[model samples]
Target: MIKGIKGVKDILPEETPRWRLIEETARRWAVLYGFHEIRVPIFEVTALFARSIGASTDIVEKEMYTFQDRDGTSITLRPEGTAGTVRAYIEHNRAADPLPQKYFYTGPMFRHERPQAGRLRQFHQFGVESFGVADPRADVEVIALLWRMLSDLKLPSMTLEINNLGYAADREAYRPQLVAFLKQREETLCGNCRRRIDANPLRVLDCKVPQCRAATEAAPRLADCLSEQARAHFGSVLGELEAIGIPYSLNHRLVRGLDYYCLTTFEVTSTSLGAQNAVGAGGRYDALVETLGGPVTPAVGFAVGVERMAMMLPLAASSSESASVYVAGFGDRGSAAGFSALEELRLAGIRAVTDFRSGSLKSHLRQADRLRSQFALIIGDDEVVKGSAILRDMETKVQQEVFLTSLSSQVSSLLRIS
Candidate 1:
């Protein structure tokens, strides 16, 4: 037998309801916020991520799956949703519209990584991206939409960690100071930080190495580097969040791991999960559109891992109860009657199943018991001659003979009582 690939999972039938609930909740909440759904291709030109997500970032460097197609064009499976969404927005000239555009998408994202709890090589993300709006109110609106989405799922113990990375001018002014501080302790820092100092120095603050963490405790905060204009904008964003009663915390060291992010960066974390427990994160990317060779447009968005979301949502409340009706037949003639009755039950809006293979009544009931069927419709050669079925209630072990024409009404009434 052929084995499945490592670092990927098959979502079994039993786990589908949880996935369904998550998707349903996201669709409903997204619609509530006036965000329509847009889907981009799973694979796109390799240059898209390099220019938009940052070539030096881990997502583009070590994690992405890139390959050449038969036509010799380089194609890559998207590791994140925002960059592609932005690409579509620019390519289609969505800015031509007078109003800001909001879109939400749910799909699988690919990354080549070592598998761990709640992380997979091929995983799913539900994301929202808003374009053409630079107002601070837009920031609060997006964040509030995400918070309400989590609440709708009945997730537990989540906190919003909010921060402003400031604009390009603020970040540029602070880089020298941040670099000088790191340079003083270069020998004590890890090799990654050593290279990061020259490449993407802001990332030095986000390093997870214990030694690097010890070495960079005194690093200058981004808040102090904010330009006067950037500071005012950040203040306005906070005021809006406060006025709307959205809870948030100021994390000085929460420099988002992406270079494109600017002005605002935030994460929603859950306490139930440990260190890598962030369930959702996003920030503004004002320069990303211009950087991608499109007319400058401001955008902000967030992506939530479906796996992590599933871990937080309570399991289905009624999963333990039997909800289906099973139809069984004891002989070939009885089988014909059973199938016809199965259709009748289905037309009457009953969750009904039937045994195609002729079997003993006892064996069929055993199968129904295993399936946890709410009721079992038993048809035998004698019953077919009489044009009636014996309906057995699995829970109460009560049996009653009902005419063929009356079975649909009886089952419908029983299900309604349920």
Candidate 2:
């Protein structure tokens, strides 16, 4: 039997409501922040990610699903959303319109990695990008947006960790000092950290290997290397966050694994999700637009893992409940009446359904009970002749006759109760 490929799982019907809630909440809050929606293709030319996400980054080096098309052109399913979004911003001449372009996107992203509890080969993300805003307040606002969305989701026990990576020149000065420090402990570091010391020393700080983590623990901090300008920028970002009462902690070792990010970086972690604890993260990438062949643009954005967020959502609110009504009919005349009444309830915007089989009233009532319907509208030859039908309350099992024309109003009254 054919099976779904490993690392991919179906989002069945029962689970979609929570997914919808997350997506809708993101869209709602995104609009409230004046961010317009932007849709990018699921796949793009391979070079887009390689250049924008950094050639040596794990996303590019190890995780991207890259392949060659029949035309022999390299292509890749997007591992993240920002690169494609920035590409679209450039391709469409969006920079010409305004100083700041705010866009949000929600969609599937692909990465080839060992799937864990909340992480998947095919995962969905809700991301937002703000371009052309270089002010430190832009950083704070992006962080605020993320905080607000997560807060609105009612997640429990979350912590926001932020750090300063400084500017390119600042990093250049610090890079040598960090390398020299790591070189002394190279024998104790993991193989990956040993290789990264020369290629991208900052990545070594992000390594999870126990020995490498210990080796880099006492190493030079990025904050120590921040240029005056970078320090002021980061300070101003913090000042804004403080003024607004958004609590955050500084973690000097929290360098994000992206080459493009600079100045300020952040991640929101929840205690509920073990191991893969980071629910969302992003940073300022002031040079990425120019790196991707567009005019220099300053941007800050963050993406939340939808699956992880879904996992933490409260189950009580998401569980299915009894629908408003089930329209059940007994015979030919009764079924016709029930169908007409069903349409009336529907056109009135009541949640209504019917068993079209025109089965016996007892069987139809049982079907309605099975469906968890709040009310069952039973129609038979006698009630059809009288221009009315019996409305049976499924829970109370109380029966009442109602005129066909007034069924909607009657049900509306019943549904309004606490």
TM-score to native of every candidate shown: 0.94, 0.93
Which residue pairs show collisions in model 1? none
Model 1 CA deviation exceeding 4 Å by range: 314-323, 405-410
**Per-residue alpha-carbon lDDT of candidate 2 for residues 71-165, written as tens digits (9 for 90 to 100):** 99999999999999999999999999964599999999999999999889999999999999999998998899999989998999999999999
- For 1-418, candidate 1 gives per-residue lDDT tens digits of 9877787789887677888888889889989998999999999999998888888888889999999989999999999898889889889998888766999999999999898877889999999998888898888888998999998888899999988888888888999999999999999999989999989888888788998988888888878878887888788989999998889998777878777999988999999876568899998999998998888888888888898988776666325534479998778778888888899998988889866663888889888988889889998889999989988889998888888878899878766776
Q: What TM-score should be assigned to candidate 2?
A: 0.93
| Model 1 alpha-carbon miss at residue 40, Å | 1.2
Each candidate: RMSD: 2.0, 2.1
Worst 10 residues of 1 by lDDT: 314-323
Off by over 4 Å in 2: 319-322, 405-418
What would the C-alpha RMSD of candidate 2 be, to one decimal place? 2.1
